[model samples]
Target: MKRIMLIVSYNGANYCGWQKQNNAISIEEVINTKLKELLKEDICVIGASRTDAGVHAKGNVAVFDTETTIPPEKIAYALNARLPQDIRIQESREVRADFHPRYDKNNKKYSYRILNTKINVPIYNEYTMHASNYLDIELMKNAAQYIVGEHDFKSFCAANTGVKTTVREVYSLEITKNNNDIITIEITGNGFLYNMVRIIVGTLIQVGTGKIKPEYVAEIIAAKDRSKAGPTAKAKGLTLEEIYY
Candidate 1:
């Protein structure tokens, strides 16, 4: 058997999430179904991340072992022919037999987008979180500074997460705005707890809206209480931007 790694991207609006579920469709399920059809064997994909419902991905990674004679470099082209337009396999290659996408990830980057304008653009409605009010970009930037280091991110994670430790290292965090009134918050980290990116975006939005002081971010982190953080941002506005191994 040969292990093949695939780089994938998808618009998550139409699927439940990345993982296979009992009553819903998923990206992994679709990929596996197509792989089975193409290779004439049952296949299961191992994804780098289990992104939540409505969350998109630009550079998600997955791996599967197969015994087919097909070359690894041809897998992307073969899979793309079967995948829907909303999902695409960007690249594929053979990997060392022991390489596991999730366990071997060196870092991951996520980005959350906000449409901070009076009117929402029809074209981008599915991709951005619309906020009618003007946001204080400076305050959001200030709040982001507090998140750029190793910390126990209990306040930012979803309650009931099975992980025993909430500590993660934030390599970088930045907020930027464009002329089209689109605000993007990009964060790179060693790892993230469940719902961590959405919570961070929500807290930053509170800071931008003056509901929370920028300095309070540090306090919230120190408190290690979920209730102290802002609400979780909408999943549709969040995307897994990249993964490094």
Candidate 2:
């Protein structure tokens, strides 16, 4: 059997999450079902990242072993024909049979989008978080700088994540606003704990609103207490932007 790696993109609005679950549809379940139909074999894909429900992905990776004679490069087109419009296989290629997408990952980048408007913009509601308060991007950027290097990210992780360790390395963090007033917070890191990105964004929002000073972020990180940070941002605003191997 040969392992094929697939680059998947999906709109997470209709699925429970990337992982399969009983009594609910998921991006993974759908992909598995479609692959089974296409290859006439039970195919299960191991995703590089198990993104949470309502979290979209632009370049999530997955790998599955198959015995079919189909060309690797053409699998994307064949799979797209079977997948729903909301989920597309961007690319497919052969990989070493031992390559594990999750374990082989180098780093990933996530983007949290905020629609900074007094009134909700219905058109962008599904993908962007609507924020009524004015967020000072410059202050947010200043706060982001404090967490740029390797450190224990316990303050940004979920309260009960149950991970083996809370330490992680953040390569970069950027908060920017476009002309349309949509604020985008992009963070790149070696790995992330559950809800880490969301918590960081929430804490940065506090700084933007003058509730927390930019320089105070260093203290929050040093505290390493979940309660010391701001509220976790909603999942809808967060997207798995890219994964690098």
Index of the highest-lDDT prediction:
1
lDDT of 1 at 214: 99
Total colliding residue pairs, candidate 1: 0
Predicted candidate 2, C-alpha RMSD: 0.8
Question: 17-133 in candidate 2: lDDT tens per residue?
Answer: 999999999999999999999999999999999999999999999999999999999999999999999999999999999999898857999999999988998999879999999
lDDT of each: 0.95, 0.93
Q: Report clash pairs, candidate 1.
A: none
C-alpha lDDT of candidate 2 relative to the true structure: 0.93
- Report the alpha-carbon TM-score of model 1 versus the true structure: 0.98
lDDT of 2 at 102: 92
Relative to the true structure, candidate 2 reaches a TM of: 0.98
